[model samples]
Target: MLWPNATRVLSKMGLLARLAAHCDSNTHFLVRTSSGKVLMKIALGDFDVPAICVRRADLLAALLSALPSEQILLGHEFRHLEQSGERVRIHFADGTSKEHDAVIGADGIRSRVRQTLFGKSDPIYRGYLIWRGVARYEGNAIEPGANSESWGAGKRFGILAIGEGKFTWYATLNTLADHSDSPDGRKSEIQKEFAGWHAPISNLVDATPDEEILKHLAYDNIPLRRWGVGRVTLLGDAAHPCTPNLGQGGCMALEDALVLAKCIVNHNSIQAGLRRYGSLRYSRTRHIQQRSLLMGHIGQWKNPLVVGGRRVVTNLLPARIFEHNLRRVYSYELPGS
Candidate 1:
């Protein structure tokens, strides 16, 4: 279910098999509250999603390595953008400029490319901090390929297997936005905050290498009513940034890449292609963005009574409802070949 078109495209390029060799094909996901009781359990493979997790660096490296050298330009920090008639001029920090028929702003949340078009679309913080890292699995109740997320009072923790015995772990804390500390300091804070949470929570945090831990403030941007103008277009976080609650940031970006390519290939000109791409993508991305925000809000509920109610509701909910929603999410397939 994950990477439907992406798998095909990589397979065509003879890279899917190579990538699959190292990726984590999770078959199920388990959800729990801080009380150590299972709240929800989902069988991912039942929905036909074979592969679930990919190491970010590995995927990016593989894609870049597959591309021809001449097609890539590295280390040129994007400075600004200028549009003159039919061409868009890209200015780099290294004092170089280039013009192209179209520009795709996949530059991320703090995108200079997006800033040129929509001035100061800074991401709004959602009053949470996320500490994430990959740690060696050390005898947790959860098995490999079985993703798990546990919710606590205004906090949450996740475990997803990447490959081998390594698990990608993330913990969220509800706090003032933009507050941060040194890596060592953040690591200490996380350990203290989740000290008494549950079994695997402490085990994972304690096992993580101090240097490998990362801390980031969770933030998301408002979706643009329109994604582009003229020959310039936006993709990924530049167009629709959402909180990580739904784990669809990378998935949505991959979808964007495919649709953008399809639109361009089907259109006669760059402008038409960009417009069509926006038309096809805007609504879906907006829906996901709003849904992700809502999910984050719900997941971060601080009141114990509310959290208990959530657990009750989750327990009482029919499995079919979960299946239907997941089916809708995984049902997205690229239009035509």
Candidate 2:
């Protein structure tokens, strides 16, 4: 859903055909994994989340207008250069020369765009790692024929049904004092952390082949005062990388696209629009990032004392607080929405 504005922008420029979604049942996807037969069930916010599926190729296919020209480039390295006004200069690896009316850094974490604009900063590691995988469900896992994730002390779990028989599950566990970047080491670490967990939890791990299980050290970046300078701006993780605890990183990006497009429409020049985009998006995104990091830290506490304290306070936290907090983020209607 978030990719719509970008697709719409390209389509308006005659760079794409059409941008659409698969809300109907006819839409389908195929995953060629050896995880036996895949059946998935996903529950979000304690409710079944209807899937609005879209294939990556289909999305790209709509943008076939640019296929002939090949003007679009990938794998270009971000090379920083000095800039004038509120804008900055950046170079690509191919030595190709061009400057955007405004540069928006949507790059993911380990963002070269963020570092280029602001010097390197250390990530706030939340004392845990997330290991995830997709597998075929054996049926009867979900009573309502849905997917769900369970939260436990010092651990967390997720189940996402991706149509057909496939389900994606992720497990979060507190890591040891020293966690390595190696995939195997992280996998082993999760196994040790969740050794005495629920059966389904261990089953997912056992089913996930070595390569299939992806280990990601959980880290979230802090908020920054400046997200843009004139013609250059940052978006998504480049500006504020939030922890997955909120599952709002992509949602925030979707909002960013809409707001940016609207700001561009309102402002006379791309520079003004970029600045306005940054001005408007900075605070909101930063709040989410900071809050999510705090949530992850609390959710994945390594100390039993802290875990027990959290459990006690969990009941005291009002239901309205949870709903209201999430509403502030999700139910927001962008000016252009």
Instruction: Give the alpha-carbon lDDT of every model.
Output: 0.79, 0.61
The candidate that achieves the highest lDDT relative to the unseen native structure: 1
lDDT of each residue in 1-337, candidate 2, tens digit only: 2223233344344533333333222112211111212222112232112223233355456546546656667677776755766445668777754555567888777777778778898666767778877666565643333434455667777665544555567777777636665555645656776676544556666667767777777777778778876677787777778778766676577568778888989988887787788788887888888788877876676577775566556545544555456546544545541
Best by TM-score: 1
Q: Which ten residues in a row have the lowest lDDT in candidate 1?
A: 1-10
TM, every model: 0.93, 0.74
lDDT, candidate 1, at 95: 99
Give the Cα-based TM-score of candidate 1 against the true structure: 0.93
328 in model 1: Cα distance from truth in Å?
1.3
